[model samples]
Target: MKDTKILKIHNKSDKPDNIVIRDNNLIEECIIIEKSLPNFMKDYFVYLKGSVSVSTRHAYLKDIKFFCNYLVESQELTIAKEICDITLEEFNLIKARDVNLFLGDYCTRYYKHTSQDTTLIYENNNRALARKKSSLSTLFKFMFRNEQLDSNITDGFNPIKLPKPQPDAIKRLDIDEVAKMLDSVENGYGLTDKEKVYWRKTKLRDKAILALFVTYGLRLNELRELNISSFNFSRGEFKIYRKRGKEVLMPINHTCEVVVKDYIYNERTKSELLAEEHKDALFLSLQNKRITPKAIRQLVKKYTSISMETSRDSGYSPHKLRATAATSLIQNGFSIYDVQNLLDHDNVTTTQLYAAHKKHVKRDIVNNFEWIDDKKETSLD
Candidate 1:
């Protein structure tokens, strides 16, 4: 007879916010990927877990996993037969030039066979290549710091030059467009009768969602992770978990207060309306589940597309709505530094990009400050 102890399942509502739970799930994913990697790479995983944001750590681990797979799969370049079998000695043999070719040639374009008759081609731009490089760099640097590497091979790795973001390339809705989007959310303007049916039931909820996005300029995940307790109406503020595990308090304005109150009191279904686990979630789907990022994106697109007078498919994401908020605030004479703090940007230069948005600036300046008399100039011509 074989005897084994029963594993106890302890899943329950213990965490204060869903963001912490989501972050822990991401960390678990990193650990799962790390388990598939070689033993020597475990230190790097621990280092990342301690030092980096959950998303960044996940990306780094994924990149490392891809690289390890590449090392084993590329028969001509590596002696190792599998990723798990890749030893520290085998990894130490990897030269800077080998990595350069892998990033520059292999990562730029690749094909993955899905089935006997199907294949998927993947391409990485300079930004993606740079990220992969940064991942490798961090790994090597960490190992080198601990004397696990023969030398800091990252020094020899060729630098990937990335294109600088230009102000003219920024996409955001102007002030009038912002007003139009809000109006559409409130009144269900331009929605097909079919969409309007759903919109009518969720109008207050939708309005609250859009209002918070535009007012707070929240990242998709940050807003998605909101809990009912995160808001303190009497205090006129809400708490949000930011990147790298920062908890920031954001002041709630009158408009946001009204819309959120309207949704919670009038439209938001609670208790049996939820899937038991998502009882504390701020936004909800028709299926009584916490709203997913994709759903939020689609709603943003629906209203923004109406505002832009574009096709439904041409609608913007929550991020574009974030850009709209930044530009609108800046255009209305708010300090860029203040906007930077509000947006939780690490650099003021990022806020400067929003400040540099020149929507109608050229024409407005010319129209308001015409130095030459148009009639005289026309007669001379």
Candidate 2:
């Protein structure tokens, strides 16, 4: 079966959320043709007709483009003249064998390069390459449907088995390391007395952001989209409008709640925030506009750099904070099922990446499973 993730349009109906999968038997597989080609291609049309959000569409575009660049460079196919040069017929011809060969060769040639340097795979994985791949994939699919062929060549072809370079294992901060990092933030690159005061207030907001992500596993986008009114204090739940524009209420623990309360009551109020007519953005920059993703990233990087210096190897990224929260929750005896629900992952497998074996903790706790002799039998008398 083709393992596909379907996008659902958010409907604010009273009915409960339902997902509709559209792979394999979902559609009566057939091949058709048209006089004229599609604007993009067949694969892309499927995605567009489905409920994919803008960001998701953009990401798919990027991934496809990266693949396209590889095709162009490796095959020596000059497709820049007209986008149509990469037709469905052409795409199907490029098989899994080709993809596997390309990935193996690419990784072998250029794997360990640092961020400062450029390599073939690195260069092809940029935003532009993503768009190219997206457009190209759709074109291929369109041709399979419309272009006259013996059969559905696209379907006959095997799925690409690209190399997924294993990411660094999940690294989380202990309570002491988290505290030390927070303490060190007051001393950053350059701070005058005025800057120090400014940093103090900013630090509170930064700490709150990190604390929430670490404690709650909120995504960077989810946290950025939050408003002062997003939280219901009485219920201890914050409403998050997720990527697909679905509303989800995230329950918070006391620590995260405290940090949020402190940020709003003490720091955010004093930032001289100015909102545009439609701008109900929760997080604001010093200039008072809604904080951009880049700004948030920079803020995370700065704190992460400071945190790394204090001995935590993974540093303080928003994502690292999210991973930390997931790992920590699992280590504290939370089930993978509970973690999946809390993290709001659509798939259990996404949650399982963090749902790992607790080998280190088990070694320490295994002995304690047997009751102490003094405590075991005294109640019998």
Off by over 4 Å in 2: 1-43, 63-80, 84-168, 182-197, 269-273, 277-279, 304-314, 349-357, 367-381
Over 32-117, each residue of candidate 1 has an lDDT whose tens digit, in order, gives 89899999887787788778898999999999999989988886555778788888887777789988999999999999999999
Q: Number of clashing residue pairs in every model? A: 0, 15
Indicate the TM-score of model 1: 0.91
TM-scores for every candidate against the unseen true structure:
0.91, 0.65
lDDT of 1 at 337: 90
Runs of candidate 1 exceeding 4 Å displacement: 1-15, 358-363, 370-381
Query: Which numbered prediction scores highest in lDDT against the true structure?
Result: 1
TM-score of 2: 0.65
The most accurate candidate by TM-score is 1
